[model samples]
Target: MSIANQIIKQFPDLLIKKDEPLSKYTYTKTGGQADIFIMPRTVSEAQAVVAFAASEAIALTILGNGSNLIVKDGGIRGIVMHLDLLHTIRREDTCIIAGSGAKLIEVSRFALSESLSGLEFACGIPGSIGGALYMNAGAYGGEISDVLNSATVLTRTGELLHLERDQLAAKYRHSTISEKDLIVLEAEFALTLTERQPIETKMAELTEARESKQPLEYPSCGSVFKRPPGHFAGKLIQDSGLQGKQIGGVQVSLKHAGFMVNVGGGTATDYLHLIEYVQQTVKEKFDVELETEVKIIGEDA
Candidate 1:
């Protein structure tokens, strides 16, 4: 029997789908499909799936909230696991324990409700805790590395490990998780006790700033390019006169040059073309190399 068949037979209670359209799961609303998609509700179920894939030598992909990601037109092979059902948040005095699948926004709100101040910066980030940890996600002068105390992860070989902040080596939208190919199951963040009103005030200010600066109305993968050294990606793109540039249904957002928005029925190919065009244009004009912040995955069409 095939790996997919074996998975179904062994874990009949697990939700599994074949040839699932990945566009429905991504932020840009593009991509083809996944050979197998599994949604694991509990940590035990997630571990079992990981162990099965490891034993079978099948390719495994971990998907968080699908923000800051682009799936290719040809789709993903092997097993794609989504941990959306694992969303959970609990407070332990000054620290917050959040499941990998919990939305960062929700976690921030939970902190706010508990009079915690450290996570206010993440209130506007549109990703789950796991995804944020994977990329060391940051905004408005704050980053995940600032508060992350430790993470619980499962190795590719099915070994569960607890990694401290130093073990993560998170920096500038990069983390050791990708290099190690480990799956973050949960995270603990150290926070400070503060006045709820001030935390709420800061969150409000950040949310307003994001709303005013970002093209949130369109389907996009957030900022497409990372800040290049001393230069800002948006400023460089805007200076290069690439704003509002379009290829197929994808366009360099007029509202914010840093974003590549899906104007309509866009494809991953279109998104890639636009990215290349912008990169080439910016390099030719400013002589600075713009690196992508978005994580592109799966096979090409």
Candidate 2:
């Protein structure tokens, strides 16, 4: 049987898109086609799909909002399972139950409307809840771990488990989840209710700061590199005179040294080249190795 037929025979109702363009799924708007893109409608269905992939030894990957990721020109291999359809939020008294696929923006809006104070920092973060957990995404001194209560995850071996905040071993853009090959299903966050006006004010403040600092007008991942110890990545890059640098259609933003923008017709190769250029320049100028903040995946160019 053909690979397509093989997949269909196993997942009767699974929605599979053949040769789906990776550009449509990434914030960078650049990538080759994925062999098959799958989205399971329910968590159980997702679990079942994952198990089957493991049993069949099919290569698998999970796609979130694409906010913090870059798919290369050669594209992602095997089946890319997106759980964006699983987005749902519920308020259970003092805690919020959110599906892993939920967007941080939507969760922030809901939290603000309900006077939930702890999520204000996430108001402008452009990643899904699951992606946020994986990276421990944060802004304005607050992080996912600050409000996270617990999460349900599925191990690669198909075992389901619950992990609390303390158990997550979350740190700056790193988590125990990163160390393990586990898929997050859902998460619970404990929050305190505050006045609506204050919540609105804080959200607006964060938004304004983002607007002033980021090159949101361009298609780019938020920050290209992480803050190296004792120094800011953006400042170092700027100081190295690498801002406004270009590689094909990709340019290091004039507005922010931290971002690499798809100015007009940027490609994945262009972005990676720019990233490499920045890393090399910074290393040469300051003897500091700048690490990328955006996750680079898929095939090598």
Candidate 3:
């Protein structure tokens, strides 16, 4: 039997789709299809999929929140798993317990509603809770590592682990979760009890700053490059006069040089080529190498 057939046989009630276009799920709205798409309703179902993929030697890819990611035109091989159904958020004392699939922005608002501080920096970050933890996502001088208390994850072998903040080894848009291939199921964030008005005010300020600067009106994978030491990627790109430069349907944001926005029907190939061009131009002009913060995956057309 084929792998898809076997998968159905093993998990009869699990939600699955074959050859589904990933463009429907991505922020950029430009991606190919997923070979075997699975959306697990519960952690157990997610665990089973992981275990089965491991045992069968089938490549498995997790589609977290679908931001800061680019899937190539040829689509992905093997199974693509999304945890959208696992989203749930609740409060426990001074801590907020959130499922992996919960939106980071929603979690930040939830904290504000509960009169909690510490998550104000994340009010505009567009990523799932798990994706935020995986990448140590941050903005405006605060990072996920700052408020995270602990997390529950699954190893490739399907072993469950409850790891503390230190175990994550989060630093500047990076985490051990990627290195260890751990699947984040849920997270606990330790926040401070504060006046609701202050939290709301802080969030408002940050939101204004983000909206005024970022190219929020376009379909773009947030910041395209990581900040190099002592130099901002956007500044360098702007200094190189590469802003508004176009490659196919993708162009460097006229508003923000760090972002590559799709003016119209942009493709992953276009984005990749534009990224290369920007990196090359910036390197030649400023002697600084631009490394991508956005994760690029899938096969080429």
Alpha-carbon local distance difference test for all models:
0.94, 0.89, 0.93
* Cα lDDT of model 1 by residue, 183-205, tens digit: 99999999999889999999999
Query: What's the distance in Å from true for residue 287, model 1?
Result: 0.9
Residues 1-301 of candidate 2 have per-residue lDDT tens digits of 8666788888889888878888998899998878878998899889987887788887888888999889999987778889898899999987888998999989999988788889999999999988998888998999999999999988886678899888998888888777796788898999998789999999999999999999999999778888899999999999999888999999999999889899999999999989998899999999999988899889965
Alpha-carbon error at 57 in model 2, in Å? 0.6
Query: Where in model 2 is the C-alpha error above 4 Å?
Result: none
TM-score of each: 0.99, 0.98, 0.99
Q: How many backbone clashes does candidate 2 have?
A: 0
Query: Once superposed on the true structure, which residue ranges of model 1 sit more than 4 Å away at CA?
Result: none
Question: Candidate 3: which stretches are off by over 4 Å?
Answer: none
TM-score of candidate 2 on Cα atoms, chains taken together? 0.98
The order by descending lDDT is: 1, 3, 2
Candidate ordering by TM-score (highest first):
3, 1, 2
Please write out the lDDT profile of model 3 over residues 1-301, one tens digit for every residue: 9999999999999999999999887888889999999999999999999999999999999988888999999999999999888899999999999999999999999999899899999999999998898899999999999999999999988888999888988889889887797999999999999899989988999999999999999898889999999999999999999989998899999999999999998999999999999999999998998999999999999
Q: How well does candidate 1 score on lDDT at residue 289?
A: 96
Give me the displacement of residue 212 in model 2, in angstroms.
Answer: 1.6
- What TM-score does model 1 achieve against the real structure? 0.99
Backbone clash pairs for candidate 2 read: none
